[model samples]
Target: MIGQGFRGPGADIGDRPETFAMAQALENCSKNPIDPEDGTAIMTTDHAQPPRAREQFRQHLATVLADLQETAAQDGEAVALIGSLATQLSDKFRQASWSRAKDAMSADNYDELLQSFEKQGNALHQAGRTKQAYAVQALATSLVAGTQRADTVIAQGEGLLDALIDRSVALYRQHLAKRH
Candidate 1:
């Protein structure tokens, strides 16, 4: 009913019913409500933007990861700093508008990455790696915040997410090395 008079056979255009029906279908898809939690639409409205956003996110993620790798190399134990970073991550995520990067990626991808960090963080905590655990949890929080923020500025968000993931992975690796 929404796109009825605009694109389908009911419209003024002399298009075939099947074609118009397909077009209507597409329109409906694009209009599907976004997931309130993730702020991404069920169907991407702009097909062209997703690839660009995804590529930009990937590049930004890479750069941040590189920076995080460097930071991890010079790692120190700063419990206060980790707590503050975690709080920042939470605040940023809560303030972000996720709709901007909705088509950039799938929720599963984000979930998988975040889950990995959480799993690693808990393990580290259980093994008496408090600093590393806190850091890893903060990293997980950053990924959500970064992805949410990317909707506003892709590069900035990607960089943040990338850096967080890189740091989290590095910490996890360090824990593994110590365990073995």
Candidate 2:
């Protein structure tokens, strides 16, 4: 929920500087947390992301696979489709991220740079350097937008895929009914 507790993404952030500042403060405060009872670590806001986010991503892929299996003519077809789609999407994601990173120092260092910026932004905020922190965070946002676009493309693809699934299911039911 890194972007949560902030103004809606659609809001005119430029029109409300105070809102932006407040959002930054709230974001920094919740970036990391500790379990109060057992004193265990709770959540982490590293570039690697929290476990819950990763789990949700896996579940999303599983759901898509399930839908594919429901519509595929055979189990092998479904497996092959998922494999192909996964490979294509991973390549696309890497390409997009690398395109963004190319002008910067080096493609391989892009991830490390993003993580460094994020950590530095948080550190600057803690040090009461809000303006500098905001600037650094904005830079990080720009770098990450490429991968975010890849995710959005996948989501858009899912929407179309879901429509196809619905149609396939309907046709399947009709065929079963006719057999009876």
* Candidate 1 lDDT tens digits, 76-147: 443233434443443344422222222243555445545456566546544545455445533543444343
Q: Cα RMSD to native, each candidate?
A: 19.9, 17.8
Pairs of residues clashing in candidate 2: none
Best by lDDT: 1
Give all candidates' CA lDDT scores: 0.41, 0.38
Predicted candidate 2 versus true structure: per-residue lDDT over 1-180, tens digit per residue:
112222211223344333223223223322333457875443332324345553444343334334344535444333333333323322444532223222333333444555566666556555644434433433343333323223453344334443433333344444546889
TM-score of each: 0.30, 0.31
Superposed model 2: Cα runs more than 4 Å off: 1-107, 152-180
Give the range of the ten consecutive residues with the poorest summed lDDT in model 1: 1-10
